[model samples]
Every structure is written in C-alpha cells, then in structure tokens.
Target: MPNAVSLAPAVSAQSVAPAFHEPLHTAHDDDAWWRSSVIYQVYPRSFRDLNGDGQGDLAGITAELHQLADLSIDAIWMSPFYTSPQRDGGYDVADYCDVDPMFGTLDDFDKLTARASELGIKVIVDLVPNHCSSEHPLFKAALTAGPGSDERAMFIFRDGTGPDGSNPPNNWQSHFGGSAWTRTLNDDGTPGQWYLHLFDSSQPDFNWDNPAVHAEFERILRFWLDRNVTGFRVDVAHALVKADGLPDWGGRPDGCSSDGYPGHAAPMFGQKEIHDIYRRWRSVLAEYDGDRILCAEASIDPLSRLVNWVRHDQMHQAFNFAYLHHPWNAAELRGIITDSLQAFDSVNAPTTWVLSNHDVTRHATRLGENNPEVGLDRARAASLAMLALPGGVYLYQGEELGLPDHLDIPDEQRQDPTFIRTGGERVGRDGSRVPLPWRADEPHYGFGSTSGGWLPQPEDWYTLARDVQQTDPDSTLNLYRSALALRKQLRLGAGSLSWAADYMDTDIIAFLNNDVMVIMNMGESDAYVPSGTVIAGSHADAGAEGVLAPNRCVWIKLN
Candidate 1:
C-alpha cells in the first residue's frame, strides 16, 4: 500500500473560503516551473491573429498573453515558430535562431518574451532536434559534397543496390506512409542515393552521432535561455539518437513497420545513449538557474517506462498520451489515474498530464461534438481531475471554452501533411488548429479582421467565444478561472497527495491533499456522494447535490 498524505481537519461547507495563492516551490534547479504549475499550449498559428495575414504570429501571441494570465495559467508552451517551409506544419526548421518571417520578426519575439514574463507566465518554445527541412543549408551542402564528404556525414547517407534496383536502402516506412528514404540523384546524373526521413520526405532526420550537431543544439538552447525564454518542449526527443549500423528490422506479424520498412524495431531512436544527451542538456539548463524545464514528447504507453525519462537526470516531464486516448469511463479513468500516481510515486518523479494537444482531436469533439453542454461538462470534469493530480498539468488553447474539433474542413482546404499523405484516412490536425474565437461578434471571431487566419475558424466557435463567455457567470471560461483560482487558493500544487478511501469507486475519482478533497465523476450521469461537504462545484447551490450531474466535479471539505 502507498503512504498517503493526510487532509487537514474538516471545515464547514458554508464558510466563505479564502482563495488559495502561494508561491510555487522548486524541486531542483533546471526543473520546470510547470512541475507544480499549469501550462497552456498555444499553437501560434491557431491561437490568435493580430496582423490580419490570416495566420497567427508572435505579435498576436504577445497581444493575447493577458488572456492566459487571466486564466491563471503558470506557463505557455508555444509551438515551433522558427523559419520553415511549412512542410510539416513548422516542424521542419530552416533556421533555428530566427523567428519565421511569416510569424513576425525577432523584435516581435522579444516583445512576446518580455510581455509573457511581465504577466508571470514562463514561455517555453518547441525544440525540434530530430530533423530539419530538406531545404536547409546543411542538406544542400550534403547534396553538393557527395558521399564521403564531411557534410554528407552530417546526415545518414547510404549507397547500395537493393534486392531490386528500385527498392530503398531499407524497408522503413515514413510515418506518413510510403518509403522513408527519398532518392536524391547525384549531380553526375547517376542513380540517386537514399536519405532517411521518419515523417515527411521533406523533413530529413538529424544525425545525433555528430559532435557538431550536439554542440550546435547546445548553443541554440543557450541562445534562447539568454533571451529569457524559460525552456523547451523537445519534439520527438527520443529520436535524437538512433541505433548504429542501420540494421534491417525483422518482419513482424503485427503489421508494424519501421521508418516504412517492415519489422524495423531498431533501438537507434530510443537508445539509452539519449540519457547522456539529456544530461548534457540538463547541465546547460543548470548554468542558467535550473528553473528551466526540458519536457519530452514520448507517446509510448504503459507510462511506467516513460517516467524513466523524467527521473531527475533526464527530462523534467514527458507528456502522457495514454489517458488522452482512452474512452471516457469511470473504471478506466480511475484505474489510469490510480496507476499513474502509483507509477510516479514509485520513482519519486513528478508526473505530467495532458488531455488535448495540437496533434490530437479536441476533447470537446471526443465527448460529443453536437452537444455543447456535454462537451463543456467534460471539459470541466477533465480540468478538475487534471488539477487534483499530484503532478503537473497542461491545457491546450480553447480547451477551457470546450472548443470542438472543426469537422467542416473542405477536402481541398486541408493543410496537414499527415492527412495529405494518408489520403484523408487520418483526420488532419487542421480541425483543431482553427483560430481562437476571442469575441462572438468580432470579425474573424476577434482574432483579426484584416489578418486572415491560417486555418478556417469554426462557425460554432463564435457562440462559445471568449468575450461571450466572459460575460456569462456560468460559462465554462469562468469555471476554468474559478478552478485555477481554487487550485492556487488551496495551495494544492505544493501539497502532498494521497488517494482517499473511496478513491477507487468507479463513479468517483477523489484525492486528498492537506485540507482539501477533490472529487470528480467521469460518468455521463450524476454520481451519488457518500460523504464530504461540497465547498465548490459546477453549481451555484452548494449543499443541494444528490448526484454529481453528468461530467460534474466538486472540491469538498471532509468532516
């Protein structure tokens, strides 16, 4: 049995409770402020637009910092805004140091950094270390230098005749389907050699084996830290290192393909050597104040093994995707939360939870696309559950308002490279990437009248717009504000957590911390309370509850 953190003695439900506000505690230097804080991810292209270019930019983000501050978010994880050809939705970096002109100038980034800091929110940018655009100067140099040239060694290059002259160097398939290797013909007009790409052929993988690569990335980290950027959300971080020797993956009956090749379970990508690299990054982060965080994007399930990446020496946290993928069920959610807490406790490593992100379907759509109330209720429940956990939490943009996935994208208007590659079987992320609706009546939903959004805005979003919700006392946005205020007021982030006695009940998910008990119902119907007086809930009436209501939550004071 796990040791539990005891709750403070009971208080009356009718007492007008004081708000919870306490300074955040730090576990170590180079650790993320988000460990005990709430972070909201802003996919810049979809967050807001100030310039009317029909795209979101750094300036737009700067303009919207107050919205996040208003919600009491502790930090912001801005997606990649670096120069790119948009081949992989800005994941393919053309320049690491400068902001893409489409997003705005370096001056704009400086302004955003300063404004976010002023608002008390840490800014963490996405760091894509695994690959760069095929148009990158390094790739061009590799092409011009030919095999055996030092530049050619910067990336993986192989020359050989396959079983069939038409086959690739290996059987690996790209994440977007088709062969992972693209044949780049030599300048001599001879048969082209193959280069590896894990995703789009336009985005080639980086070779971490090179000393120059590590040094270059370290310098990049320092550049941002020096500029006051708090930290990084490492993209495909596990792929930084790859297995040597480029061995062919053995065939599997499970239909699993590696890189595009059948049976390629190469240890190269998630190799243990990655730890050494993480340690190196950690050391650099320490040079600053150790307050900087390094969050990894490892999507593997059975989160136990993934937590290893966060055990003090490697990453500060790795986003857990399993719970995000599960269906809404009382038993399932309870098991997941309980098991995850247990796993994190075993290692003494803090955990991080995320329900929606730029890459996944919006939670509102997951709950029930047509029923806004259901979606809003689920959003409230999810937020409450996430905050009550003992570790960190991340909330995607527009999630607080219960934004639903935009299913109205026309076939021709789709922009996601993944959807294009998969022939639309895979829902492109464009639906979730729609511009934020700041005001229901404003032109372009208050994103910008003159500036056209990169992705189309959902017409329905206007109904749930920020400005509209701000006026409604019972709106989801206000609920989020209240939830965040309560989280801070209770000093919940700093308090130790324990599974309460009734925590395992299928209908109720409860946790005790100091004097507070947070209980949530994942069921689609009202849940009966066994004990405890409700202090705050998804209701104005405090003591009248019999069932928790579909997707409702409560923060209770135990007697």
Candidate 2:
C-alpha cells in the first residue's frame, strides 16, 4: 500500500492524487527507544563546520556523532537543515523531502542518519508543519493563481477588509514580530490578495482545512520515513489547525510584541482540530514496522491541555516545558515534576525533561544573577537532578560545556529576526545560538579549522571549550559524561521517585529513584546527606562527607 490519502473536497482532487506509491516507512519494537532516551538537539549551522566554510552542515553533524554517542545520549533531535532563505533559522522550510545546499545534499543527510544508526543513535529530524517558505512552488502558484483558484485555496489567502481591499481581514499577529498577514502584488503588477503567516512574512501558513494540505504532509512524512530516519520532532506542533471562522484574536494594536500574540484560546493556535491531524499521522507511523515516534514542540498552557497532545493514540512524547520554566527552587521544581509526571502518566506517555534549547536562555545564565561561576554551579546541579528524574531528557548543544548565553553580541552581527523585527527592545534567541567552542586554543575555539562559525564566539568561551574540559574529571563536560554513564548503569530512566524524609531540609531536594538516592541543596547553607556510597557529584564541594554544598547535588547508591 502506498502512503496516498484523499482530501475532503475542501481542496480540489486534481491538485493531488488519492492513490499512489511515492515512498514507504516501517517500524520495529526495538527497545521502545523513545521511552527512556537522552536526546541532544543539534542546531546545524552552529554545531560544527566540516568544510570550514564557517557554516555547519550535514557532513559536520555526521562527523560529530562519536561525541554524542560518547556522551551516552540515545538520540539526536536536529534542528531544520532544509532549503530556505533562513528567515527564521531554517524553521521556514522550502522543501520537505530534500536538504538545503548549505547543509549539504540528500546524500549527506542519508550518510548522517546511517552513521548514527550504526552507533545505536536514533535520528529525529525537525519537521516544520505549521508554515513553509513563501517560495514553495505551491505557494508561488497560490500567488500567481489569484483569488478563487485551487492554488490560492492551498494557503490561507483572503480578501482584505476595506473597499480597496487594503486592510487585513482580522486582528491576528505573527509569532515572530509583525502582522500575521502579508500583502502580495498581483501578476499584473497590481496589489492583490493577502496571505496569513503565523510567523515571518516569508513563511506563510498552510490551510489545514484544505484537504490538499493534509495529503501533501502525509506524503512528506513518507518521503523521510523511506530514508530510514527514526522519527520527527514536529515544529509548531499545535498551531497547525485554525478555529472556526478565523475570528478576531484581540491582539496588540501595534500588531507586534516580544512574545507575539496570545495563543491560549486564540483562533489560530491551540485549537481542538489540531489533534485529528496528529491522530492520522500516528496511524501512518504505525503502518511501518518500528514504533516510529512523534514528539511535539507545542507550547500550550495548563498541564492538562499539554498532556492532550500525548494521548496514547497521538504523540508519544511532548516537551515538558513547565518543568523547564520552573525556577531553581526545591519546592517549585518538585511540584512541577510531580504534576508533569502525573499528567503524562495518566496518558501513558513518557515525560520529556529539558533545561535548555535553541529558543530560550541557557540554564547556566538563567538560574543565576550576573555571575557566571554561580550560574555554572546551579546549572551542573540542575543537570544531575533532571537526569535522575523518571522520564526522557533533551540536552541542548554547548550546554554540557556549561556555556552561558553570549549577552554582548554586537547588533550588526545578530541574525535572529525576533531581535531585528522587535526594534532591539528584545534580545531574542541569537545570543543563545552563538557558535560553540570546541578547542581552547583554536580560533573560534575549533568550531571550524579557520574562521569563527557563522555566529561569533565570545572570548570567554575558550575556558569552557571541549579540549579544556574533556580530560578534567571535575569539568562540566566530564561531569555530564560520568553522570550519564551512571544513569544508564542504575537504570534510572524509568523508575519511581520518592522523597527521602530524613534527608529533607527546607530547601533541600533529596529523592530516591527506585533505590538510588539523589540529593540537591538549593539553599544558602550546607545540608546533611543520609548514609550512602557517593557515586557522582556536580562539583568538588559535593566531595565532602554527608554534606552537600549550596547549589550542589550528588547521586548516591543505597541498597
């Protein structure tokens, strides 16, 4: 059977065929790999540069799997490397089935996946489903076809409100930094129809209400599945479906803010109609042999609503962002962990914990004042704590190096649209996406053989580079290496967690995962630890006997 699907008449059948074999995908029971995996996110352009073109590419990623495998992570969740103008860091994909030339060719991607598979590393590529590069052939046709044509129906195009059709249809706003609508000139050189873009103007939203959109995405999925990729990390997972009537969202009068518009109950995002698409996608994955997985980047509020996307028949794992947003307080962290675990447990889905990602500030910078040393201590402690919890985990690139956000990147060098479009009021995500420092002595710290990466690296990064810390037992890099080794040895990935009554202090979080004791002191003073053999510690201060230092944590073995 081919991966052909029919549109529901809202779109014309002539636009796409209902039955045809383009490609195929299959799955296997193979360890239920997603259940207890530690997945690392690789932002392609900033990870490594193979050709020293100062741009990271597929060949660079393929060459770096040994480092990831050595770190003991089970999988890799790579950011988008598809062809695009890079208006939004590759999230605005122009092609679904091919890799961008800057990232390398399809052959490079296939070799990367094959190498990762050989290392027992599952490859989960990013899939941008909500919107696409406006340059897509379908969207180009939509612009050329004008109103009432099947091409125009492929996207969310509508007539403007004013008499001359000069005003937008509603009050929606872009998630990047401006109005969600962008007007285009007609083929005849006259002002024409408006199209909705949830983010940048170059990235236009698709009409999921249109059947052609549904069938097209299904084929896209099969195209990658045929390439032997393990799964997809869906970008903007929940905002795909629009509500009835595309009603007014009461967004800002200026039509742009740092966080963009509210999505809690907005007509454009978090609608109930989105899950049906996932359910269909889930069925398609099941058609294959392996337990092909779907993980979401949905930012819905309320643990209950967030859990809805991870129901047994929908996605397998959804990022537990609530846990990430929690401050470094013992009670707050514990409360979020309990709530998140309970919510996902109810759905029989595994909770995925993360402290840093491409979209936010690094935890080292987030948990402390303007103090890098203090921030590093808290970040190391937090990493050990998150790894011990009973769920999967996501480690962002450069975080293991204890890297902090580059707070001083020059304005001219910054590339994130969020920063450029917001008129500099917001710092945006570029600071956190700066190139990584791999060698202490090399220019750009070994991110490339010659020049600095596409994004510049700060001078201070040399001290935290991989070459400086890889051999040091007490370095943050080595600490992660040792902790993950122990995590696997203890089988802490899926287990029951309980608070240790005797080890509890006002700001101390001491929990037992299965039987191994995990302790963290988030207070201003030292806390007593119960009798047990110390296995691992975040910092040298945790080396003291039965005493865990402030902003330090340790894993203990107790039978």
Q: Which model scores highest in lDDT?
A: 2
* C-alpha RMSD between model 1 and the true structure: 6.0
Query: Clash number for model 1?
Result: 28
CA-only RMSD, every prediction: 6.0, 12.8
Scanning candidate 2 in windows of ten residues, the lowest lDDT window is 1-10
| Shift in Å, residue 338, candidate 1 | 2.3
lDDT of 1: 0.75
Superposed by TM-score, candidate 2 places the C-alpha of residue 449 at a distance from the truth, in angstroms, of 2.7
For candidate 2, write residues 309-373 as lDDT tens digits: 99988999999889887787776776787688778877777889999999999999988767888
lDDT of 1 by residue, 387-455 (tens): 766577889999888788888988888888888888988867888888889988888889887645667
TM-score on alpha carbons, each prediction = 0.89, 0.91
